[model samples]
Target: MLRIITEPTEAKTELERISGRTQGGETLQQEAAVREILQAVKRVGDEALLDYTAKFDGQVLKAEQLRVSGSELDAAYHQVSREFVDAITLACRQIKAFHRQRMPKSWVQFGQDEIVLGKRYNAVDRAGLYVPGGRAAYPSTVLMNAIPAQVAQVPRIVMVTPPGEDGKVNPAVLVAAQEAGVSEIYRVGGAQAVAALAYGTKTLPKVDVITGPGNIYVTLAKKMVYGVVGIDSLAGPSEVLIIADQQAKAVHVAADLLAQAEHDPMAAAILLTTDETLAKQVKQEVEQQLRNHPRRLLTEKAIAHYGLIVVVDSLSRAAELSNLFAPEHLELEIAEPWDLLEQIRHAGAIFLGNSTPEAVGDYLAGPNHTLPTSGAARYASALGVETFMKHSSLIQYSPTALQKVSNAIETLAKAEGLHSHSESVRLRREMDNG
Candidate 1:
């Protein structure tokens, strides 16, 4: 059952607790366990990956069978329906087009002193994509993570996913990977899979960056391996904070909340509304909808523990509480969504108007669905092409340019006690003068 709170102070306390759900003390044990998995993979490579797959995923895989075969990739298309293929193709095209617009270009600027300065953006040599597959198949995640890397022109895009107990990867996931231009995929997941991507197994190539969402073990592994390889973000569970006005439909709002809750038991769904009646209605509606939910036990646990509805004085107050939460998905079911959007400073993604739901963004909306969770939206953003690429500062100084700034450079270097630095500038100027 969803809880409804009318008191603002109580609502804030509950919101804070929910926002910090990922940082609970229990993670210390999980982190330690993840560390062992990482070390094991780093030390033994493919041998360790095979062991962990058997231990964690309940599937025994040979070193040779660790990588998904071309025959399986071809069969994935036949396994899935034409409707799924068509939908995935549409998502791939839409996602690729959107990311193409976001691709950062290398630029150079000629300054007053003929000093060339700019930034050069280049894709990493290889990128590893982690697609979670436990409760559901996330072909959308495949397209979301892989398409961005493809658009960024990452030379090699690799994917890794956990196989089912039958030791078969989801056909839909494989089809999505193919549509998104990810040809190299491995049949492995969990912390060990992350380590293999970061440190490289005999079968898996070392990648420059890893992107996607996963369970706690996967998230911990990504966090631990960040310095070894770039990561998209330490994504927490999925979350959504919706602000609904009187005009918003109670049933629609409740469905949106449940849509997020169904992702995981730790996922959160919240509502901040000025209408007390609507808040109560949504609360009732949430329970009503969950009665026959396909994922009832899992969604019920999420709703019972983390789901909340708060009745506030105004939309401004709702936005204030929302900013404090920094929700991963924010839906504005208000009459004037834009008016409230100005007050919202932080949110991973915002859905405006009653018709717009977070599901669209999760699937085919232009923006990336892999967003920051656990209040990370305050500082982080949705994963995109930028996650698979890096920039280098480009600088060039002509003789005249060096001469003009040599004295200042030498003074600054000497002040810092870097004699070689000062000498380098002075010698350059002297050589140019001669």
Candidate 2:
């Protein structure tokens, strides 16, 4: 059952204390393991990748067979039901539309004196997307990570995922990749796959950027390879914060909270409301809902560890407490959601009204589901086309324009005692005079 707190001071302290516990210590042994895997793959290339595939995944694959074939993708489309195909197609359209609207475009501005300054946006050469596989297969992740890169016009999009014991990639994942325009696929995963993408293997070329969610080893590998290749934000465990009021349904609030809790044992599910009765009702509903969930054990662990229900003095107080938590997903279950939107200063994604659930944003909603986790909502944003593109500022100054700023530049250079910097400007002035 979720814990309930009434006092404001107690609630704040409890939240902080629980959050600290959730951010637990790592094993130095785990770091050493990941480092060894990364270095081996970096040194031996495809040979090391094949060995790790057999050792970790229990499947041995040839270098040529690393990339999934077109026939396999075709078979995947046939294997899934028509309903699923239609759903995936619909999601693809929505995701593409949302990212297309936000696609960055190159721009140039010119002045009367022939001086031009602007920005040019270019997509990365290639991107590597890591999709988690095993008991659960998330085709949605493939679509979310690959579609934005496609929309950004990335020339090559490569996907890496662990193969099953049978040495076959998930058909649903493959189909989603094909639909989302992924040109390459690799049957490798974990820190070794991350290393291959960061520092090219013989079979897998290095990518300009890497994006997706994975286990702690994958997250740590991305952190270690920051300088070699760009990466999406270092995502932590999933989290959801729901702010409800007297008008909110207890069942709806509870269901949303459990949805996040089922993700992982470290995930957080929090509820803040002005009505004590509603908090009590939702707490009961959560227990009732947990009994029916298939992942009840995992959800129960998450709830017992990180979940909370706080009954605040007012809705304004609830929002204030929420901003401090900076949860990854925020749901406004109050009467006037838009009115309270201004009060929400920190959250990776916000779902408005009782009908708008966090699950909608996770799969079918147009917004990118790859979000900052833990308390990263304080600064980071959801993954989008911007994550796959680089921006370069353009500056052009004619002789007259250079002449206008030359004295200012020289004066600043002189103040710093850099005579050579001033001399460069003086040389230009003399050349123009001649």
Candidate 3:
């Protein structure tokens, strides 16, 4: 059951406990396992990927079976309904339009002294996207990760997901990948898959950047392989903080909390409200709702450990607590949601009013749902077109432009005690004079 804490001190303590969910002795052991898998994949290549897939996923496959065949992608269309096709198509359109608006354009600025400087943005050569498969298939994840890379015009987008017991990728995920313009896919997953992308496997080529969410093993592998390649962010378990007022419906708030809790056993669902009566009602509603929930076991586990409700004095206090948590998803379930939005400072994504549920953003609200979690919203942002691309500083200086700045450059270099730096500038200036 969700506890209702009225004391500010107790509320803060609960917050600390939830925020530190993924830490401790358990995570240390998990990291060791992830490290071993990563090292084996690095050393053995395709042999390691197949070996681990057999052990973990209970599927045995050869090198050729690692890559999903084109026929499978084509057949996937027939498996899904026409409505699904249309829905995925609509999601792709919305996601593409949203990201296109944020596309970074390369530009060069020329100055009066023949000095040129600007930024040139270009997509990475190859990007690997990891989409979790098993208990749930996330076609939404496919669009979220691949659409941004598509907008960035990445040359190749490679996808990896765990195959089912039948040794086949989910049809919906395959269709979503095709819709998002990601043609290359491999039926490999877990830390070994991340290792294959970071380093190169005989079957799968190395990728420049990897973006997607996975289990603890996948997260650990990404953390370990940071400098080896680029990663979007070290994603953690999902979380949500709802700031509700008198107008907010108890059932709706309860549902939102459950939605987050159902994601993982460690997922956090918190509610901060001014109405003590409403808090009690929502807690009861959560209990009633979970009675028939399909994911009741894990969801109940999450709520029992990480769920919280704080009865604050005002909506401002709720927002303050929400900012402190820096939740991945923040919902303003208030009558004056727009007004309350100004008070919010740190949140990965904000859903305004009682109607705008976080699930909308999760499925197809056009905004990428792959957000910074575990308080990462305090510093980072949601994934977008920028994740797959890099920028280089474009610089050019004419001889006269060099002449004007040479003395300043030389003086600065001399101050830093770098003779060669000054000599290079002195030589350039001498050539101009000569």
Candidate 4:
């Protein structure tokens, strides 16, 4: 059962438990394991990758069988139902549209005397996306991670996922990748997969950036290899904060909270409501709904460990607590959601009204579902075209423009006691004068 906190003091304690240190107590061990795996991959290249695939994923795949071929992708499409294929295609279109609008555009401006300054946006040469494939198939993840790279015009988009016991990738994932326009797909995952992308193996090429969520091992691996290669974020367990009022439906709120709870045992599901009666009702509803979910065990563990229902004095207090938590997914299930929306200052993604559930954003809604987890919403944002592109500042100064700022530059340089720095500008000024 979820903890019920009524007093402000209890609320603070419960909120700490919910938003506190993420999947703690494993950082050092995870970092060590990741370092070992990364070093092994770095030393042995493709051989180490293959060995780890067998040891961890239980599939002994050769280098030739690592990359999924065109025929295999076609077969994967045939494996899934037509409805699923159509749904994937539709999702691809929606995600593509959302990212297209958010893509940064290069711009140039011509100032007087050719003192031009602007920026140019360019996509990375290659991007590697990791898709989790342990308990469930994540075709949606494939679409979320790969579509932005496609929209950003990445030259090559490669995806890595662990193969199943049969040494085959999930067909649904393959179909989604094909729909999202991925350039390559590999059968690898865990820290080994991250290593393969960071330091290119004999078969897998090193990528400019890696994106997507995974378990602790994968997250730590990304963190260790950050400078060697770019990573999206050091994602932690999933989290959701629902701000509801007496007018909100307990069942909907409960279901939404459980949606994130079922993601992982460390996942957090928090409910902030003004009505004590509603808080109790929603807690009961969550347990009742859990009975029917296939992942009831996992959801139950998550709720028992980190879940909480806080009864605040007013809706404003609820909003304040929600902002403090900075949850990955925040749902406003109240009478006037939009009115309270202005009160929410932080959150990765906001679901307005009862109809707009977090699940909608996860699947078909035009927003990228890859969000910042573990209070990261306080600063980071959801995955988008900007994540896959690089920005370069453009600057140009003509002789006249240089002359306009030469004196100021010399004065500042001289103030810093750098004679050489000032002399560079002084020399140029002398040439102009001559």
- For model 2, the stretches where C-alpha displacement exceeds 4 angstroms are 18-24
- Please write out the lDDT profile of model 4 over residues 123-146, one tens digit for every residue: 999999999999899999999999
Error of 4 at 211 (Å): 0.4
lDDT of 2 by residue, 1-434 (tens): 79999988999987776555535545789788889988998899999999988898898789998878777877888778888878889999999999999998899999967999999999999999999886588899999999999999999888999998778888888888888887588889988899999999889999999999988889889988888999998887788999999999999999999999998898889999989899999999999998889999999999998999999988889889988888889999989999999899999999999899999999878999998776777889999999999999999988888888899999999999999999999889778878
Q: How well does each candidate superpose onto the true structure, as a TM-score?
A: 0.98, 0.97, 0.97, 0.97
- Which ranges of candidate 4 are over 4 A from the true structure? none
Say which prediction, candidate 1 or candidate 4, comes out ahead on TM-score: 1
Question: How high is the CA lDDT of each candidate model?
Answer: 0.93, 0.89, 0.93, 0.89
Better of 1 and 2 by TM-score: 1
Give each prediction's root-mean-square deviation over alpha carbons.
1.2, 1.4, 1.3, 1.3
- Quickly count the clashes in candidate 1: 0
Clashing pairs in 1: none
Poorly placed runs, candidate 3 (over 4 Å): 24-26
- Model 2 scores a C-alpha lDDT of 0.89
lDDT string for model 3 (235-352, tens) is: 8889999999888899999999999999988899999999999999999999999999999999999999999999999988888888888999999999899999888889999999
Provide the lDDT at 408 for model 2.
Answer: 96
lDDT of 4 at 318: 87
